[model samples]
Target: MTTGNDTARTTVVVVTWRGREHVTACLDAVAGQTRAHRILVVDNASDDGTAALLAAHPSRPAVTRLGTNLGYAGGLAAALPDVGTEFVAWLNDDAVPAPDWLALLEDALDKDQGAAAASARMETAGGEPISLGVTLTADGHGADTTDTGTETTGVFGFCGGAALLRTEALRRVGGVPAEFFCYYEDTDTSWRLRLGGWTVLPVPDARVVHRHGASSRPGSREFHRWNERNRLYMLIRCAPAGVAARECARFAALTAVLPLRRLAGRNLPPAWNFRTGLRVQVLTEVLTRLIPLTRQRRAITARAVVPRPVVWSSANPPR
Candidate 1:
């Protein structure tokens, strides 16, 4: 079922950490892509035989093995420098895309010269739509957009799970903020793309079924720690001044008040016993890194092609 159009200009980069179970199937799906995408697997120091499996796979995707367990963002950061493709598409090791997934995404970007990235419509194994793109929450956290009705629409961000990014656009934004490690990295980059006057679009026809949390289980302490901390980092680096300041103030206030409320035996938010501690740690970490964060914020501001107000206003456009 190959598309006659040439697709050698695109590279599929899959980042995996201890993903022995799904790497084979993931690669198989990539191999079946209607367009012949060059495949690459970035192994994040997985000692679980995942590296060996990839090496032996018949399709023989080029492998880059990092010595340390740099998270997904780090994995991409490592591989992206070596990627000479016009486009780079990331497919999670645990996700399997439709046969025509790459073809459709490539088509979308080909048609829209202004779009820096195109997000895929992702679903669960049972065919439940899970993510279309990213929508900024009222609290400034990144959440997935689940609108299935749109064929293609402007979005604030792309999900790292399944998205095709223009190589030059990505390099211009500094190639996937490796500082983020994993969580919210894509959203942060999306913000950068928008600020640089590049559009992010959702292409619902390009589909991927992801086994969410296959690498890091949601709600786990590790997940919350990185997720919470990274959200603040992303806001500080990419959000408008008013939005960043307000969210940071609220976070600090919550950190201070939540402990007192618990001591008073007031009913705390469910699952917040640990969250209070997480907030404190996140606040401290952000403060410790404030100098670097401020530098990044200034850098983003200096290179921005679109005004902050305009980017923030379109964060969650009317469906």
Candidate 2:
């Protein structure tokens, strides 16, 4: 979806790494967007010759090749300042969006003056439903909500994998958290935008087909470690004042308990690899930055106009 700018109001950014098989189709689909938009590809040092492939394409999108992989969020963040558009749309190289995907999200954001972002309905390429939108629990556990034919603007956050972001709003909060590097960065950004008094919404009619974990191999030790650790950072860095104490206690307790529980079969998930050292690392990561996170909390506390409860509520308002 486009926001009606004379010279491409939105810059569609696709981040890729050794994604030669998938990037071609993804680029073609992006070129077919119903609305006019610019395209950019940030290559995270793909040895697969993804750059050569892009160079030969008719679209000839501007490409930035990095020396080493910067994970998903880092690659995109690196390209943000030069985006030069009112909005930015992210497409996972593993996902291909429907032609109207950008248009629908653009329309939703245009109509909602306070909304900072809008996400497309995503499903797997095999037609399995992924997420219609999102909502979060009191403890910062995010859940994907399937489309129920009654979808609305409310959502916990846009999955960074595919979504439209308001450029100015994104820059105001210092862009995505690079410390997260990859996983949970979007969740942390969502909390920051909400706390900055902007709503993150969903365009349920806008659709995309995502090949889940195509770039980052699922269940990889690196993936799981970052997954658990970043989730902790997300809650600690942005959980509201009311939810902070409980969320922190739960996070700290789990950081300690996940390792210990692996000692007993009845309490452990079979796949648990017993990374006791990684668990300790996650526990201390936040405590090391207590001063900075507290400063962030204060800024969010003072700027937050929307009550945390209202921003988090899942109850559908009467339509």
Best by lDDT: 1
- Give lDDT tens digits, candidate 1, residues 1-319: 1111244878889999999988888988998888867877889999999988988888888888899999988988888887778899887999999999998999999999999999999999898999999988877899998876444456778988999999999998767778778889889999999999999889988989898988877877767878888988988998888988898998898888877887899976665325677777788899999999999889888888998878887874455
List pairs with backbone clashes in candidate 2.
1-102, 1-103
TM-score of each: 0.94, 0.87
RMSD of every prediction: 3.0, 3.6
Number of residue pairs clashing in candidate 1, backbone atoms closer than 3 angstroms, sequence gap of 3 or more or interchain: 0
lDDT of 2 by residue, 127-225 (tens): 777876566665566667775552543676878888999999998866877667677877778877887788778777788998888888777777766
RMSD of 2: 3.6
lDDT of 2 at 96: 92
CA displacement after TM-score superposition, residue 232 of candidate 2 (Å): 1.7
Q: Ten consecutive residues with minimal summed lDDT in candidate 1?
A: 1-10
